[model samples]
Target: MAAYGRGAGVAGREDLPVLLVAVLLAAAACSIAQAQQQPVYTSIYDVISNRSDLSTMKRLVDGLGLANQLTSGTFTAFLPDNNAWAQAFTAAGVTEAQMLTTYRDPATTLVNFHLVSRFTTIVNGSIYNNALKISDLAVNSTRSYDTEAGRADSDYGLALTRAGNDTDGAGGVQVMGRSGPPALIAANQSDIAAGLSYCNVISAVARFWFDTYFDIITKSSVTASSASFAGLVAAGGQQQWLKDTTLTGTLFAPDNAAIAKVQADLKLNFSTALSQQDAADLVRYHMTDVPFNRSAPVNPVATKLKDATLTWNGGQFLSVAGTLGRPSNNVRWVGFPRSASVVPLLDAALLPLPSTAWKLVVAKSAAAGASASSGFSSFIKAMEAQMVVRYQMDDTSKVVTVYAPTDAAFARLESYTGKPFASLASAIKDQIVSMHVTQGAAYTPSGLLTATPLDTMAGSRTLNVTRASNSAAGVQLSGGQTPRGAAAIVASDNVMYGRSIVHTLDQVLIPAGVVLPQGGGGAAGVASAPSGWALLLLVALAVCVQRWALAAA
Candidate 1:
């Protein structure tokens, strides 16, 4: 009986251990289920109100009368914390009191820029909700989204840039306003409540778009790199145009370095009073009546200057082809406002006219003789023989495009005609040179490729411009006589001389009614054109002659 009692006691102890293990396992399962469940809330307003860091956002929403919209909409809110609001106010050099009083409309617009909605549409009798999640954004790329802000349909309300592979990590996402620095997303601050999503940002987005062009240009904090440009505007007495909110346009502002270089080159003194007419003309040349942004198409945009136009080529890097062929350096699209979009840090300023085409041709001939590539010795000789051609090449007032023949081109002509270019009659030489010069418009290579039949200086004669198969020399020009064929532009945008541009050609252009010396064999030996300092001296003499002739006239 005693042995049976001890065995029963041991069995009871064993059962005690098993019972404790079972209880522990059940509690672990319950905890896991609770962790996986999503939190529930009433609306986006409730979510913001519950967060201690988002007091500023809540106040702005309530003050702006936007609480009702946030209470029921399927929307996403990029809320700036109280700290962010404070920093933004400091940067803008304004207080919250001023925002509520003096800048109420802009403050309202600022709040609206933060809210984006999910679009609900019926497709094929089925409901679809196009709501964006942080996961939906591509890594390391900028994406545009529509916000509640009232802006043009073509304009982007918000530009979101995602940086890292981890979407949920800290500092992985940022939002850019029309200008200034981008606002960063705080870590683990994203939440969804009642179909509304919200993310807290560390800084407030800029409110530049609401300001006028003058306001932005003059703001030191906003445009520190563009101080020179702002000074030019002030000196030019064109502040009224930029300050006026009713006027809208685009300003291609050159940076301080570019402005300084141009000022020195042109012997300009912005510190002193300038002629209003000259200043106005210079200012107008840098602006366009229409506003253009980063998303603007690659097309010719008309500037305020009637004849001058700029071509903006859209890509990873934005570039503008102005009076000076597309600048060797890149042109950046800095930012935009409601009144104006400012593209800045241009390597060179856009001038109304470059240096004289004749001077450039003469310099090229001097630097490199007829035997070397890009030599224009023969073309120079032809121009020197014609006083009228010299006048056109040297004139700064008249814009023109010159399709200059290379020494090789003249050699080709000589080979075809069986007569040296120097032996040609003065009448024939004048006609040949005139046909190469297109007056009234200084077309860049890009302009020439797309231009219609262009009338040359040679009375009533037109040249047909077309695209060439050779990618290096992208353009071809055909004269009135078809049998003479086409002259390929060997080198395009070779020089930007005063109000004119030069393109090197492989063959001489022959206009109709001008008879060529008929022969098949090679020409006799001709006198070599001037070279070195001698050619340069000739160029100086030509300039003096041009000035004297103009002064006499």
Candidate 2:
């Protein structure tokens, strides 16, 4: 009898509400597992095979050479088809160089801002909001997840539309936007309306797109000849040499203009004075070593040429400490031939560099050549002890906003005459970095909406808003009447589209002295960064639950 009772009790316990709870938990777990399945299409062809946008899809695919990668697995491509390319095509007057060199693209930003770590089905609304996801990363391409507000603003199906690459008829070209249309009419309209208002911004930030995070051969169409400073003159076995060098060996193969510059500068015959070895060093000076697409080493130590007289523009791009700026043209790597390559016979002339003696054999001695400061410098002195952002991989996806000041801006700092760099505190004593410290990427705009706030490394900024000659709110940056403030935003939203951002500011800002800009990093005083542990934990818990459930079953 005792045995029977015990057995009965155990059985009852197993069948009680506890059993119901376990079953429900199992179902919920399964749902989550399904959610994690992610979207997978073996190849782009697979998607095209079933979709009606055949011809359109093919053109874009060929342009990007995405098919090869698609064959391996599924990908959530930020598809910007011909139409997308075209819209920019008309507005595209913003030269690829400008786009690559300046401005920001919300869509492109999302593509890079978020990661493809695991397959993420980024339906539009999956990422959107005024609230930025990676707070540490001061990018405007933030994700706002508020469904109601987004839907109210017609945010729902937005992500879904992007996934579908939806389109509308307004645009003569086919593309998609938050509203879901095959036409780029919306983007265009926005560009048109906000364009002039933020033309500088778009041009600068979009340069991010042009900026390479990986090694690339920045090329454009050119006859097998010399035409510009950035033009190539490789031929025969030399062409092989061009192909042999790593991407870091930027071939400043002079365009006619650049070649002309070199001739004028050195009194040399472009045809004979410059040898292939000399060409190599010219290319070397044009390139500061990077892992292919890696962003310019941050606050890279002050560079000095051991040999030649080539100089880097000594100014921080219109960028903050934690961003990639656009003043990168000063350097280029040689190996890569296509990705960000821009080739053209300069309409004018080009220049050349000395190789054997100027490059490898000697330490870089050029005061102006490739010095980290010349790449981009926003303040009088950015870092008290210049530094470098250590990187292990090519990072063409990174972009920084550089706040470049003209030669005069620095000269205005009186103390620069000869006194040691001023400390970051005293307005007149020492304040090298304190001068160029605006937070967040300030896309250069010739000018923009009167209200747009300009963030500086200062973390918070004071905009002296203005409205033409009418409103008092107009900006007054760098000693000018800016619609924004003390920060004139000479060029607003200089979008560094793909991987880099470079903006040329008229004058540098002052960081109120030693007030390190927001999120300063390095051996410097910047504090430890925020942790990604929460994110890791979240992912782990999600994974563990599935494993446990599978094992139990």
Give the TM-scores of the predictions, in the order they appear: 0.43, 0.26
Clashes of each: 6, 182
Segments of candidate 2 deviating more than 4 angstroms:
1-226, 229-381, 384-396, 415-420, 423-442, 446-451, 461-475, 478-501, 512-553
Model 1 spans > 4 angstroms off: 1-41, 46-55, 62-65, 97-109, 119-189, 192-249, 252-377, 384-388, 396-409, 412-553
The true-versus-predicted C-alpha distance at residue 377 of model 1, in Å, is 4.8
lDDT of 2 by residue, 489-512 (tens): 332222212122333344445433
Quote the positional error of residue 15 for candidate 2 in Å.
99
Most accurate candidate by TM-score:
1
lDDT of 1 at 45: 85
**Residue 195 deviation, candidate 2, in Å?**
67
lDDT of 1 at 141: 83
Cα RMSDs of all predictions?
15.7, 35.8
Show the colliding residue pairs in model 1: 354-497, 354-498, 354-499, 355-497, 355-498, 356-498
